[model samples]
Target: MATLTPCFLRIFAVLQLAACSFPEEPGPLISAPAEVVRRYPVFVGRAHRSYTRQEPLYIQTVLKVNRTLYIGARDDLYRVELDHVSGDEMFYSKKRTWESNKNDIRICRMKGKHEECRNYIKVLLSHDGGLFVCGTNAFNPLCANYTRDTLELVGEPISGMARCPYDPKHANVALFAEGSLFTGTVTDFLAIDAVIYRSLGESPALRTIKHDSKWFREPYFVSAVEWGPHIYFFFREMAMEFNYLEKVMVSRVARVCKGDLGGSQRVLERQWTSFLKARLNCSIPGDSHFYFNLLQSTSPIIRMQGRDVILGVFSTPSNSIPGSAVCAFDMQQLARVFEGRFKEQKSPESIWTPVPDEQVPKPRPGGCAVQGSRFSSSNSLPDEVLNFIKTHPLMDEAVPLLGHRPWIVKTMVRYQLNTMVVDTEAGPHRNRTVVFLGSTRGTVLKFLITPSPENPYSNTNTFLEELEGYNPERCGDDSVQARQPLSLTLDKPSHTLLLAFHSCVVRVPVARCQLHSRCMKNCIASRDPYCGWTKGSTCSLLRPGTRLPFVQDVEYGNTSHLGDCDGEFVNLFGM
Candidate 1:
């Protein structure tokens, strides 16, 4: 690598300073004129909560089981019935389940003083006909189980180090699979040790190497899920494969086997045998590599063909560029990279190189013992495989995005996209994928994913709706209330979306786009698939009683049927 000159270094520093200048617009800059654009009003329903002097009102997590919607706040849990609300209902009510005890409020000081020692429920997973709950108990986390019917605590507190975050704002993930809990988080109170641990119901826990350089490096955990026989953890961290002088961040997927157990010897005593990470590339197709380095959020969607694809929301860091992008990674594409060569750095100043197959340890490091072996337990496996996994966990090649391009790209903006949820609905001709993207401005935007007419391999997304999760006027003096989206979950049974903000949770009905449009021209111009012009001179959902004459996809902004439109639309122009 070449050394940077003083002149070039000065210019680079100036460019970094300009990246912090925030834009005035809260979201992607829309070029549509205000006159022709129709802003639809969102119908929002609130969940009730009993506020106390010490308890915070903000909702941290949202989960739906059966027909009841379960919401977790800092100190209380509530369940709201979905059947009471009619099919076309817009609002509903709530009922409380349980509140936190004084012991849950116990606190311990770590980085800052006056950090409130309160139980903020961060992890909520469903298991065995009940809910598994965890909270940040003032840096000392705790976990418990509750019955789904009564919504009451059923057992004593359990360890929650990897299940919950010490701070409410820290990134963490928890998943349940095969009657076990898998989590990735910082275990220590000072937030130092970032570990991936698997806890069986009554068996000893299995974790990654503690504070190991090759394992993790201050990772910001995004999402975790269970594939065929492997559990994958997605996160972003400083690139350890690069030279020290080049400080770049990369998104990665680390995989561990469901049957993995700790090694027997001193090399990796309670550590993972099937642990490896590879880069996730989300970039444009060009010579000048423009990378979206931040993996802010992710969602796993199972397509109609029974194939799974992970949708990730990525953005350039504040020091690089001001932009956000969405990319989808197919499981078939990711599986090939994991089977490729491994990335290794010989020296501190040297670049990463792929290790030859001959140099790789026998039993093919990171492979499960069941593969070409008879051992089912970690104690029975050979030590050579465990030793290789301790150091060579990073892969040589990077996993490319699904279509060689992002599905949605927004640049020169301010709002950072936080979370995403996807659902499939029946279109006029075929099934269409609808995406719900949450932002930091307490706004949830919806779009319909379709194929481009010009390029079959490429895809297009049509903006459908915009919803504000909270009331900006309620903030009064505090501006934080107007922003901050905590979580977003789609309820298919109720045909509603549950959005969690810093202060509360709101339910917004989907597929109501036609009811908000006043004119046929404006409805079609909005490019929303849910909104269509009907023969009754009004915008509405398609039904058996409706007669259709002018119906187009309207996704490509095609107005060729404008000449066929009759009614007040033609008379207003004096045609």
Candidate 2:
């Protein structure tokens, strides 16, 4: 027997562990189990071919007659149809073509008169048996209607009479009751200011209301609209003096109601009566810099329950968290803020309620893991393992950390967690709600919402654990998980839920009784398998040239790849 030095023993021990840690080839991809849900194909327009950006900042969906679904892409709109049998596979078709033909006669004619040509589709909707399309040109509202079938531009083109009296960049329009439209725009070249306009009836004229009060003059941008007795508008106020060190300014959600602006008709002198502003705390503690990239994109208010409002916000920078949060506020509180009278000295804190932490689902686990070691039983190393170790020099340090464990090595990986919340009809037992969240790296989380026993305002949410990550091959290479926006629209009359997501739209049948009870219970127990450490135990170090027992490959069914059964056979029967 040959004796080895201590240094040689250490090198041999390290080499042995490296040989075992490489992962085996993954199994063949399996088709997802048959599911009885309708999946519709979404058309994202052929013009989307030119949009090479990885993420789309804006995404909107509308249901057209004849069961056709139209999706608004960044530059164009697409039409899609759904299959009735399987909810997994979807077919896509192009519905409308948006070619930027600046030299076209019709486009040039429309722009020549108003001097607001630069045509771009800002909003698309099928309403009142016609297609209502709105866009901006030179900061003016360009409204047009088209025939649903012929796609011919009908009705006279309408432009704002006053040229909006504000920057076209800041203008946004919202549909009010009875064909009434409300437009809000920000002015002031140095400091931001806001103006609201109301238009009613044919040959609708625009009336501008300048809100110059101290509260209204704050550098805030109007982000969303909610319909009620009065149209509720939400704005995000930016903090004065941008913090270069922190990379973010303070922001908050504020609202103004119809009556607060003097019955929605008073044009220029109208003032915001009810103001409910809550300071946004998006900063992580102890971090000198802010995590989020932009404030305007973070705040969006959408309708939740009939009377409740939900605000979706991204806390961290665009790339930091890769997840957004939804906060809820009661509409009743908002009504009080607009109607209730108070002294200027008295601040109205009761008018706005923050969605409690219990109401929000906990953050899902991120997708990375520390590297570990693998110990091989084979005396001769595999060619693949040798190459992997050579390519990944950091694995040298990681193997020792695991105490030379017989395990595979992997690195820290991250994934996206896109989340959305929706309301369901009240059931006999409980009000049914669901949260659909998808992971970019490959998991779709369907969380069923149940009322919390301890908190009336919060809910006990459960996720589906059996379905983990999404299969990468299914979503394609260009598919982005982090930037994909999830939109859910509920058609009340049909009792159907329409979920529009990346690549496809899913229509789920909302049952009177809860299904997947077992899955829900298991998920609640496991919290969807989000908690756990990597499996396997570490190994003890051995001296070099010390003959040791071969370790079995646990993950590979204990198959040994060391000694060749094909090699010259030794006389093992008499050993």
Candidate 3:
């Protein structure tokens, strides 16, 4: 490990670097064909209350346990269960008070902020066969526990001021693992003290990183996940290494070793001994230098094989650009970048450069040392390594996106992709992977991902269906009403998608490809594992114990393996 000192020199060097500017040449907008856009049925669940004025409700988070979907909303918590075909609310708990203090509201207004200050249940985590919920209790935060069986609050409330944010729209990340809570949010009223803290049992809370521009500048956190003994946080932050006078946002993946118990008090104590961040590259290959700079959401999909892949939705840096894209990164790729040479600025003004391979610190200060029996805690690590990690938290090299290009890209559209989820299932011919994307304009999209025959390791996707997320009546006769989606969640057991909007939650069954495919060519073209073409010249959805002699291999698009389906019959539509 290399001890990083002379911080003043680095800061001075940063001030000297000249800004680089490039002319903006956005890509041309493209639209999908009409035939490929198929609509699915949706079930809208709205509040049943009757009031003089309909209050707005945002379903910010959702969780599923067996047959029920637990929805966390502004000032309320609702349990929705499958009522045979549609979702039915089992009960609604008024978990939070919607009223905000007049002083708080006035203060926020005086600061030129328009958002209301109220207690919204922002955190609804499933822990130990129960629920651990946190809410913005009228600027003051509170945490409580509830029983899933009885739907009753079981424990007394605890202070959640630092654990959750008061503003509903503010970006925060939280993940619960091994009976511990890991959270990243603002810990103050002014939204200045942004911190990441780990709370384990009754032990003293451990916090790392602060509001300092040297650490992070205007970070918008997207996702957090735990793999092995480390928890990773993903976000877009103002590029500290960039010499741009204007803000240049870069995607970042930061990791923290879970076993780290902070540094020694005087020297470098109570801070993460292993906190490292690296840039995430999701750019197109070739001379065009096309790149997806803004990261919106991330879905970590575990593969049937040993490795896992992260699927992320990104948009162009400029909000005016009408485009969005999806990219995937293998876990191995991320690990390699973290293990690579560190990036350093020789002088504060010098361009950030990667350290030579041979010059990198031995034993890699960012590497996890607590994984083995030799060192179970940070105390066992050499003092040199601990000191090196304290200052050198940012890695030089960036983690490149898998395939060197986005798997899916859409352009010429007013709406941007907001959230996504990936599900892998058994297909008629082979294993099939599907992605559900939620758009900002209240649309849910389904796409089937198949392994490219030309490149077996890579994947190609086909658009399957598009579903309307908002109800017609509630949307009114505006003729152009589109509610932005707040969250997207999957109900694995029920084979359904729970789409959360500001006004309502819509539960839509995963496209019923099995029941709807009618013709041989239709089933194959649909590229849905749920539906397959059989020998009788008819398309059939797959069912348990169902057997077929001929089923289309949608991935390779090869029919040679399967016999013909009757005679050549093309059913014409219209005219």
Best by lDDT: 1
Query: Could you give candidate 3's per-residue lDDT for residues 1-575 as a string of tens digits?
Result: 97657875664443332111122223311132322322332323343333222565556677777776677766667665544442232233223333445775566667565644556778888888888888776666777888775567786778887688867767888878676898888787677887778884543577775655655677788889998778989888888888878878888888887766776654347777678888888766653455678889999756734468888898876533456788888877887778877766667788877777665554567666645566666656667777666656778777887777677877656778978987776454336777889987777777777766776556767776676665545433213333677778777555667776666566666655544345455466556666666666566656434566556555544443333445454432211
Worst 10 residues of 2 by lDDT: 394-403
lDDT (0 to 1) per candidate = 0.70, 0.36, 0.67
Show how many residue pairs clash in every candidate, following the order shown. Answer: 0, 15, 6
Error of 2 at 153 (Å): 2.6
Model 1, 1-575: lDDT tens per residue?
99999988976765554343322323321223322222322212333223323434656777877787677766666666766653322223543334344544433543353344666778888888888988877667888988776677887888778778877767788999887789998888777899898896453578898887778988989889889888889999988887667677889999988877678776677678889999999876654557888998888755634556888999887776677788988887787788899988788678889998988876677866674456767656677777777889999989988878888776665677877888766334336677888877766777778867776545877666666654444322136544677767777655567666666555665556444345666556655554566655666654322345444355565655564444446332222
lDDT of 2 by residue, 235-353 (tens): 44443223244434344444433432221232212322223343333322221422322233322243334445443333333423233333344456544333222112113233222
Superposed model 3: Cα runs more than 4 Å off: 1-54, 83-115, 202-204, 304-306, 346-348, 356-363, 371-376, 380-384, 426-430, 475-482, 512-521, 533-540, 544-553, 556-575
- Taking all chains together, each candidate's TM-score versus the true structure is 0.84, 0.49, 0.81
Error of 2 at 471 (Å): 9.1
Q: Model 3 scores what on Cα lDDT?
A: 0.67
Q: TM-score: which candidate is best? A: 1
Candidate 1 residue 25 Cα shift, in angstroms, is 14
